[model samples]
Each structure stands twice: as structure tokens, then as C-alpha cells.
Target chain A: METRDALLEAGAALLREQPVGAVLTQVKAQPVAQRAGRTIGAFYHHWSSQEAYHRDLLAYVLDPQRLLSTAAAADTVLADLPRGLPLEEVVRRAARRNFEIVRANPYVPLILALWGKQAQDERVRELLRAHYRSVTDRLVPVYRTLFDAYGLTMRPPYTVEMFAATLTALVEGLTVRAAVEPEVVPLDLPHAGDLSAAPGAGAAGAAPWDLFSATVVGILRAMTMPADPA
Target chain B: METRDALLEAGAALLREQPVGAVLTQVKAQPVAQRAGRTIGAFYHHWSSQEAYHRDLLAYVLDPQRLLSTAAAADTVLADLPRGLPLEEVVRRAARRNFEIVRANPYVPLILALWGKQAQDERVRELLRAHYRSVTDRLVPVYRTLFDAYGLTMRPPYTVEMFAATLTALVEGLTVRAAVEPEVVPLDLPHAGDLSAAPGAGAAGAAPWDLFSATVVGILRAMTMPADPA
Candidate 1:
């Protein structure tokens, strides 16, 4: 790999293991350079300053490609939807797959830490905004197609942008919940075989993910179904 | 007024201004003591160590009383529900009040920071667990009564526990979303008058909070409504 790429790769790996704040301060250029098998001089050659290097590393760690790839993988599964599959089933599959991807990824904590930083740092805020926009741009069309496939008309006051944003927020929120209060949000860990069985199969008796998936499908249905004329 | 209380208040105040990690490390006894207008001896007299002081501060900052008081205030409004008010209106009012409380609280970022800490720290993890339980214990009955008042029966896989947990996560998640990408989550700030108008009165031409409240109400309604026999 190129010198810049190697440094970023090392930084990303280290970030997954420690808090972003720690990575930025305590773990500096020398450690990252050593991990990349490059000297501090090599690190300085590619980046202007340690802070600048860290900023680039943050961007690389949260690259839109990671999210897009997850979306793409979901698309592949969604593309092969069995004929006449129920809308709820499709939602369950999609939600479960999305949940699994987030659960498996080590970068969630780092992404969340950066989210916390966005409140205080303008540059981080802009980076996250751009990241959100890129993900939304990529996913909105997929959601539109899914709605079209199901022949469901999204109700007024709930646009495709809102759906994509809501889904992203929900997933991110639940990820935190699972980490902090697992008993309450007992999402099942990803298993080897089928994604369908993974939602409810937990060692702990509660099927939190099953409940979560059902709620997600319900929300989607409620948002898309024609409004009742009371 | 008391020494212990004074120290906690100082810590909470400082925590709101900076990241919790910084508060945990850089802002130690002397700064907190000075902030509290007490000496370092007074700080040590109240707490065993910095970590212990932080743990107590975490408890104090996330005290369920704050949440319950907000819930209680909402209850006062619900108690005076004018006859013939639609169920959705009730939901809108309740959701809006909850959103307002979270948005107004400076402790939100601190709580989120602790949530990020939960992955690596056992004490923080347990504290959050206990916090979740206490909040759930307090809120579940209130929700049950609300659903009962509306003659709605919560569907299977969406228990009162799940509802409470999901609602909490949604609020926290949206709080972070608003901070990072305010344009996307554009929740309206709390207004002076009725909570009813607080949802949609945005100048940006898009009522993000209105959409958010509607989506939340929809999720609640869907979870509580009777199942349709296919």
C-alpha cells in the first residue's frame, strides 16, 4: 500500500480499539507510524501536521464507501427478493441485514464519538454533514425503488428523505442502546447462516432484535400506508 | 448547599461545557474544587477518588428524577386533556414535551459521552444499566395508562418495556442527530405557548419536528393498535 494509505489503515485499526479522543491525543504519530511500519519522517512527509493527519484519518475511517458497500450488499439481497414476498417480510430482512452490518462493524463507536465531537468542532460537523448527505444520496433512490416495488405510496409529511434519515437515526440509536443497555435492546449478534433466523435467536430469552425489526416494519408501513380518513 | 452536592454541581456544570473524557482526566480535583468555590481538601473529604467522584456525578447528572419531573409535567397536561381531543393530539403533545426537555438539558451531551464510555468501562456500563432500569420502571406504567385511556391494546412483540426503550433511544439518537446534522433533523426549539404548535412552526419551510412528532406518534400507534387478521 502507499505510504498515506498505510498510515490511514493503521490509524483506522487503532481507532477501532481505543476512543477517538485517546487516539487523537495519547496515540500520536510515532505509534501510528510504527504500526504502519513507517518512520515518523515518512508520516510527516505525507501529512502537514499531526492534527491534519488525524483529520484525514477521521474522514478515511468514516468513509462513505463503507456505508455504501453495506447498502450495496443489502441491495444485492433485496434484488433477489422472492416473488410476492410480503412487505413486512422484506422490511424485516432489510432491517435485520442493516442491524447486522452495524453490529459487525468496529467503527460504530468511532463514528459515534465523532458525532459527539460534531457539536463542538466545526470541521467535524462539516465532515459529518457531508457524510450524511452522501449516504442519503446513495440510499434514497434504493428506498424509492423499494416503495415502488411494494406498490406502497408514502404518506404526506413523510418523504423519502425523512425515511432515510429516520432509518439511519434508528439504527445508530439502537446500536448505542445495544452497547450500553443490552438487556433492554438485546439485538442478536450476527450468525453464519441465514439472516432471517438471526433477528430473534439470542441466548438471553428476549428477542429484542425481533421486536426491533417488527417495530421498524410497522413504522415503515405506517409512514407509507394511505392515511385513514377518520 | 452541602459539600457533596456542591462538588457534584460543579462537576456537572463543567461536564456540560467540555467532553466527558476531558472532564474525567484534565479537569481533576483542583479545578472542580475551585469551581465549586471549595478547596481540594473539601473535595477529597466528600469523595474517595476522582473516579468515584465522576461515578457519582454520572449518577447525579442522569438522575431519573430529572426525567420523571419532565414526565410529571407532561402528566399534568395529560391530566387536563380536554374531552374530545384526538388521540394523535395527545401523542403530539406528549412527544413534543419530551423532545423539549431533552433539547433544553445541557446534560444530554454528557450523557451521550458516558454512553460512548460504556463500551470500555464497567462502572459506566452498570450505571447506565441501572439508569435505564430506573427510567423504565418509572415510565412504563404511565405509558400503559396512556394506551388504556385511548382504548388501545399494544400488539405482541411491542411491549411496554420495548416502547419505553425505543422512545428513549429515539430521543437520544435524534438529539445527537440534531447536534451533528441540524439541517437534516431540524427540530424546532421549544416555544413559549402550547406544545401543539411547537412541532411544525419552522421558518426553514420544512417542519422537521412536525414530521418527527408524526413519525413518533405513528410508531406508537402502530405498536399499540390491534393486529389485522390477514
Candidate 2:
């Protein structure tokens, strides 16, 4: 690759150990030199500013390729679920796969913490949007496909749309919470409840990922069914 | 009010006009001094540090009282819904009232930004948790009542829990978006489909409200119902 790529890799390594904010200080700026065995000017030669480099670092960590790979892996495995297999198992497996992929990339959460909400640069914003949307696109279809297997009635684009939006929103969000508030719940997905049975019911578990995934699945299950007069 | 109260209120007002990160430097600190006619040490004497003061300022903005008041107002209106008025109208009207309430509290978003993710102080974190839960208590019931009213099941506590966790997470996140990326929809609650119809579907034509109330109601609408599947 290029000179910039090497610097970003160095930065990403630093970011994995500490938040990007920690790296921006004057004192920390010195370490970049030691790491590269060069001066600040040399680091700045290709990247415009430290902030821009951080953004780029996030891009490299959250590359669409990584996300799509995880997504495709989950999708292909889920697609092969035998009609004999319970719907709950398929949903649980897929949810677990998604959670594990996100967990592997701790830098993904850090990058999102700093940039997913706002980036002044158009390119940065576009990159954040594209990366986020790609994940949603993959999950949305998976949810839709699962609903079909259950022989349940589902809503139109809105059902898929809201589910898609919430999933992306929640996963990105829960990652942040896990990093900051580990005590709230360990980041793990729950796998329970018979999918073909009570769609609204969830599996019992302490892992946040499980609970979160189960909850999303439960919500999807409920949405597939029409309004009930309790 | 106590001296502490005065300081907090002053800080909140000052924060509205500019970034809290910049508050100590030139603009507001001087204005606060001029108005109080008190010296810098006088204020510092009451607090642990400037950072502490800002943390307290955030606490005041996110005070449980304010959150409860909003939640209470929404609930009072919610209780009235099962009365003579039509359910659909009640939903629309409730959404409107909530929009207005959230728009009124300009400091909500500011306070959220000030809190960031990893609060250094225990009190601030507890304060934020309490403040968010206040809404969850009121809003969760509203969701339960609605879904139960029609016998339409939601994800129950998971939905409620997710609603609370994700709502605050989105706030921390979207505020950053507003500053640099006002156009990217973090929760898209404002632009979601009409709450009266599809609850979670973000509709356009949303009127702005105080940050807290809008977000509370926004999450309520966003989490309570799922979009239709195609």
C-alpha cells in the first residue's frame, strides 16, 4: 500500500488500546513519532490533520469489506437452515454470528463513537453512512427471509425499514454502551424462545448481545403478526 | 434558591449559546462573573473543579424533576386517551404534544453532549441513569398500554429496556451528528412515519420539541411498533 496506510495502521493499533481522543493530546502526539521513528511533519505529510487521520483510521477499521464478510457468512449459514430446524435456532445462530463479528473489531466501536454521529467532512460522513447502511441492508433481508420461513404475515417496506433502522441503530449503540458500561450487561446475544411459537417471547440470558438480539427477534416476530386485541 | 442552584442555572444558560468546552475561556465565564459580580474563586469555592461544575451543570439540565415533569405530562395526556377521544387521534395528538415539549428544552441536547459516554464522576453517571429511567418508567407503560389495548404484543420489557438504552445512546450519538452532520438521521424519529400509524416508522413533517421530550416520545414511537414488511 502507501505511506498513509502505514500511519493509519499504526494509529488503529494505538486506538485499539486507547480511545482516539487520548491520542490527540500534545504528549501523545510524540508517540506517533517514536512509533514511526519519524517526526510529526513526516506523519502530516500525507494526511491533512490528526482529526482527518483519525477518521481515516476509523474507515480502515470499519471497512465495508469486513462488515459484508461477516454478513455474508451469517446469511449463507442461515439460508441453509433446513425446514426441519426450528426457526428459533436459525435466528439465534444468525444473531450470534452478527454479535461476534462486531465484538471482534473493538476498533469499530471506537471509530463509531468518534465519527458515526458527526463528521465535518463530506467524505467522512459519506463513508460512515455507507458503512452503516451496508450492515443494515444485510440484516434486513435476513429478517425478511426468516419471516417467510415461518409462514407469518409481515408488513410492507415499513416493517423491513423500521427493523433495519433499529437493528443498525441498536448494534452500533449497544457496542458503545458495552465499552463504557460493561457492568450494565456483558455484550452477548441471547438465544431462547421457539421462533414458530411465541414470537414476542425472548430467551433468558445476561449477555447484552443475546438479550438485544432476542429482543430484536421478538420485535420482528410481533411485527410479522397483525395487531392483536389482547 | 441556594448558591449552588444559581451557579448551575447560570451555567445552563451560558451553555445554550456556545460549546461547554469553550465556556471557561472568554465568553460566558466573564459574563457569569459580571452578572454575579463575584470572582472566579468564589464559584470554584463551591465546586470541586471547573470540570465538576460542568458536570453539575449537566446534572441540573438532566435533573430527574425535569424528566419526570415531561414524562408526567405525556402520561397525563396518555391516560386521557382511553376516554372519549378516538385512539388514533390520541396517538397523533400525543405525538404532537411530545414534539413541542422536546423542542422547548434546548439544553437537553447540550447536556447530553456534555455527559459524553464515559462520565468521569459517579454522580453524573447515576444522574444520567436516573434521568433516563424516569422516562422509561412512564414511556414503557405507555407502550405496554397501547400494545395491550389492541391485544397487539410488543417485545415487552425488552422493548422497554431497549427503548431506554438505545434512546440515550442515540442522543449521545445524534448530538454529535447534529453538530457536524445535521442531515444524517441517527434515530430518524423525527422523520419517521406518523406515530399515529406505524409507531416506529420515522415520518417527515415532524415538529421540533425540547430535546428530551422529543427523544423520549421519539423512542416510544420508534420502539413500540415495527414497520410493515413488503
Candidate 3:
């Protein structure tokens, strides 16, 4: 790998374990350079300062393309659902796929660590804001397609934008909860066939991922179903 | 006022502006004592160490009784809903009340600031966990009452516990979002009478709190409705 790529890779790996602030202060340039098998000079050669390196790191980790690529498999899974599948089933599949994506890509800890810095760092805040907007823009259409598939209209007082926003917030929020309160927010995915027959069964024993998926799908269904005209 | 109480008050006020870690190192005990108009001796007289002071501050701010008392007015608003009110209306009222409570007693920033310390501080983590449990415990029965009033059974595959958990997660998640992304997660509470006629009115220009309240009510209604057998 190129020297710059190596440093980026090393920084990303280190950040996953320790926060950027801690890494910058405690480890400094030697450890990251050593981890990359490059000298401290090489580290400074590519980046002007620690803050600059952090900016690039934030950009690299949160790059829209990288996130979309990581999520591509899940997108494919959602796209391949049978046309005749119930909307609920489609939503369930989507939620499961999303949970699986988060589990495999495990970025919550890094994000939470960075979030603390957001209060002081404009670049960090901007990067996160852009990432959020990008994710929502990509997913809103997917949600619209699912709603269209069932001929279900979201009840008045709600819109596709609102749905996307709430869904994103829920997923992100739950991800944070799972990180800090793992017992409260498990990530295990359960067999779909078992959901209706034993709802509380999973509550007692299902992994956090399973509960998360179920909750997301349930909220989607609840949010999109046409309101009854009493 | 007692010296200890004055110090706690001073610490709480400082924390609202800066994190505990920063305050401990950057300003130290003298600043806090100065802020409280007490001498450094008085600061030590009440507390042995910075960590000890932090614990007391956490206890002081997150005192369950204080939280409950602050929330009592909102609870009364929810409890007094007319029996004849529609389930949807009841949910809307409840959402509005919850939002109002959060708005009246803003704590998301404090909670988020404290959350970063949880990994190292067992007491902080335990305090948060207990707070979550207390809030959930207090709200679950109220949800049951709302469900009963409507003669609506939460479909299988969903339990009161799950409902409470998901609802709490969504509210807390959105609250955080509103704090960080005010433009994205508006908290405007629309005039209840204008919802149907002015669905897009809020979108066009309602305050963020209104939008937040509507989103929460909509999610609650969606989550609690009986499942369709189709």
C-alpha cells in the first residue's frame, strides 16, 4: 500500500480501539507510524498536523461511497425480496439486513467516540451531518418503494421525509444504546417464522440485533399503514 | 444555604457549560469554589476529591425524585385525558406532554456529556441504567391504560415491555437529534386542530418542537395498533 494509505489504515484501526483525542495525545506519531511500518517523518510528510490527519480520517471513515458500498449487500438483499412478499415481510427483511450490516461493520463505537468531539470540532460535526443526510437521501426512496409495493399510504401528518428521518434517528439511537447498554439493546437476529408465534420468546432470549430488527420493522409498519377512517 | 449544596449547584452550572473532565483539569477546585463564592477550604470541607464531587453532582442532578417531580405535571396532563377521547388523540396528548416535559427540563446535553464517562465510571453507568429503568417503569402502566381505554390489544409478537422500550428509545433518540440537528429534527408542536388541514404547513414552517411531538405521537399510534391479519 502507498505510505499515505498505510497511515490512514493504521489510524482507522487505532481509532476503533481508542478515541482520536487519546491517540493524538498518548500514542502521538510514533505508534501510528510504527503500526504502518513507516517512520514519523512519513506520517508528517503526508499530513501537516494531527488535526489535519483527524479530518482526513473522519472523511475516510465516513465517506459516502464507502458507507454505501458496505451497505450494498444489504441493499441487494432488500431488492431481491419477492415481489409478492407482504409489506411487513419486506420491512422485516430490510431491518434484518440493516442490523446485519451494522454488526458486520461495527462503527458505533468509533462514531460515539467522535461524537464527543463534535461539540468542539466543526469539521467532525459537518462530516456527521453530511453522512446523515446522505444516508437518509438514499433510504427514503427505498422506504417509498416498500410503501408503494403494498398500496399503503402513510397516514396524514407524516411524510416520506419524516419517516426517513425518524427511522434513521431510531437506528442511530438504538446503535448508541446497544454500545453503552448492550444488555438492554441486544443485536441477535431471530428466525422470522418464530416472531408471531412467540413474540415474548425473543424478548426473553433473542439477541439485541433480533429485537432491534423486530422493533424497526414494527415501527415502519405502524408508521406507514393507512389510518382507519372511524 | 449549605456549603455542600452551594458546591453542587456550582458544579452543575459549570457542567452545563463544559464537561466534568475538562472542568476537573482546566478550572480545578479553586474555580468552582470561586464560582460558589466559597473558599477552596470550604470546597474541601464538603468533598474530599474531584471524583467525590462528581459523584455527588451526578446524584444531585439525576436524583430520581427530582426527575419525577419535574415530570409530575406532565403525568397529570396525561392522566386526566377524557375517557371518551380517541386512542389516537390520547397518544397525541401523551406525546405532547412528554415533549413539553423534555423542553421544560432540558437534560439531553447533560446526559450526553455524562455518557462518555460511563465506560470508565461504574457509578455513572449505574446511575444512567437506573434512570432508564425508572422512566420505563413509570411509563409502562400509563401506556397500558391508554391501550385499555381504546379496547385495542397490542398484537402478538409485541409486548408492553417491548413497546415501552422502543418508545423510550425513539423519544430519547429524537431528543438527541433535535439537540444536535435542530434543522433536521425540528421540535415544533403544531396546533392540534390544524394537523389534518395543515399537514404540510408544519413542514413549510412549524417549530421543531411541533414536528417532534407529531412524529412521536405518530410512532406511538403506529406501534400500538393491532396487527392486520391480512
Write down the C-alpha DockQ for each prediction: 0.15, 0.07, 0.09
Cα lDDT tens digits, model 2, B3-80, are 323322332222222212321111233333334555555555655554555444444556666653357446765676
- After TM-score superposition, the amount by which residue B126's alpha carbon in candidate 1 deviates from its true location, in angstroms, is 0.5
Interface RMSD (C-alpha) of each candidate? Answer: 16.2, 17.0, 16.5
Compose the digit string of candidate 1's lDDT tens values, residues A76-161.
44664655555555666677777777765556655665665565578878887887888788778777777777676666545677
- Models 1 onward score TM values of 0.76, 0.57, 0.68
> Which residue runs does candidate 2 get wrong by more than 4 Å?
A1-28, A35-41, A48-84, A97-124, A140-154, A157-159, A173-209, A222-230, B1-49, B66-73, B76-79, B85-124, B138-230
Of 2 and 3, the candidate ahead on TM-score is 3
Model 3, A75-186: lDDT tens digits are 8545755566554455555676665565444344344445545555687778777776787678777767666665767754456766666766666666545545666654
Two-way DockQ contest, 1 vs 3, winner: 1
- Cα RMSD of all models vs. native, in order, equals 13.2, 14.1, 13.3
DockQ of 3: 0.09
What tier of docking accuracy does candidate 1 attain? incorrect
